[model samples]
Target: MRERQPCVYILASGRHGTLYIGVTSDLLARLVQHREGLLKGFTSRYGVIRLAWFEMADTMAAAITREKQLKKWNRDWKCRLIERCNPEWDDLAISLGLPPLRTIEGTR
Candidate 1:
C-alpha cells in the first residue's frame, strides 16, 4: 500500500493450509504477479496466493534476514505467527486495494 519498500510476506492456499514465504521490495506488484500466476513455481503450483501475513522492514537486508528466519520456522510456528496478526487468515491484499480473490466451487 505504501511506496515500494522492503517487505517479508507469507502466502497461503487457505487457512492453516499450504504456506509460502517470500521477500520483495514492491509487495503490491509481487502480489499481483502471484495472483495472476505470472511468477511460476511454488506459489502458482500450490495455489498459495492469499496474503495471510506481512511485515515491512527498514531495509532490504533486514527483510531478507527475516524471510530466511521465517522459512526455517516449523509449520505450527508459522501458522501461529500468521494467526497472531491475522486470526481469520483473510487475504490482506484485498484490504490493500487489490480485488478480492474469486472462489471456485470446491477450491480453497
Candidate 2:
C-alpha cells in the first residue's frame, strides 16, 4: 500500500481567489484528483485547483478536525493562513514535482 500521511490542504483559484479546504491521507494523489476534476463539487465548479498550502497531521481524524476548523475561518483569516506559508500563493503542486495541468473546461 502507498504511504499515507494525513494532511489539511488549501486550494485556490488564483492568488486572492476562491478557496477550498480539504483533508486527505495522500496529498499527491488527492491533488491529482482535484486538478483532474475527478472528485467533482465546489472545487471543480469554481476552478479552485491551485495547491496554496498544506499542513501535516498525525492521523486522519486530526486532519479532518483541522480541515473543519479551517473551513469555519473567515475569508480574511484563511487568506492570512495561506500567505503565512505562501506569500506568492503559488501552485505548490509544481514544487511537489507534479507537472502543470493543461486546462480543460476552465480548470487547471
Candidate 3:
C-alpha cells in the first residue's frame, strides 16, 4: 500500500462560520467520513464539513503538533492561516489526491 500523508486540515460550515481543526494521515478518507456525517459529534452537529484549509507534513507527530497548536489559536489567527493558503476556501479534496465530489455524488 502507498504511504499515508500527514496533514492538518481545517473544516468549516462556510466563511466566518463554525470551524474545526484536525490532523489525519488519510485526509481523503477522513473528509469522506465528515461529508457523510459518519464521524458524529462536533463536526456533524456544526456542519463543519467544508474543506477550507490544510497543510502537508512529513510526519504524523508534526501534523498532530500543528493540529494541537491550531486548536489553541484564536479564531482570527486561524482564519488568517486558512486565507493564506486557501483564499477562496475551495474544497481541497483534489489536492489530497482524492476524487472529486462529483464522482461520489451518485454512488454509495
| Candidate 2 per-residue C-alpha lDDT over 1-45 given as tens digits, one digit per residue, 9 for 90 to 100 | 235899999999988999999998999999999988999899999
Compose the digit string of candidate 1's lDDT tens values, residues 1-108.
567999999999998899999999999999999999999999999999999999999999999999999999999999999999999999999888999899888654
How do the residues 33-75 of candidate 3 rate in per-residue lDDT, one tens digit apiece? 9988999899999878888898889899999999999999999
Query: Could you tell me the TM-score of candidate 2?
Result: 0.89
Assess the local accuracy of residue 29 in candidate 1 as a C-alpha lDDT between 0 and 100. 95
Which sections of candidate 3 miss by over 4 Å? 1-3, 94-108
C-alpha lDDT (0 to 100) for residue 2 of candidate 2: 37
Winning candidate number (lDDT): 1
Better of 1 and 2 by TM-score: 1
**Best candidate, TM-score:** 1
Model 1 worst lDDT run, 10 consecutive residues: 99-108
TM-scores, all candidates, are 0.96, 0.89, 0.83
Clashes of each: 0, 0, 0
The lDDT per prediction is 0.94, 0.90, 0.83
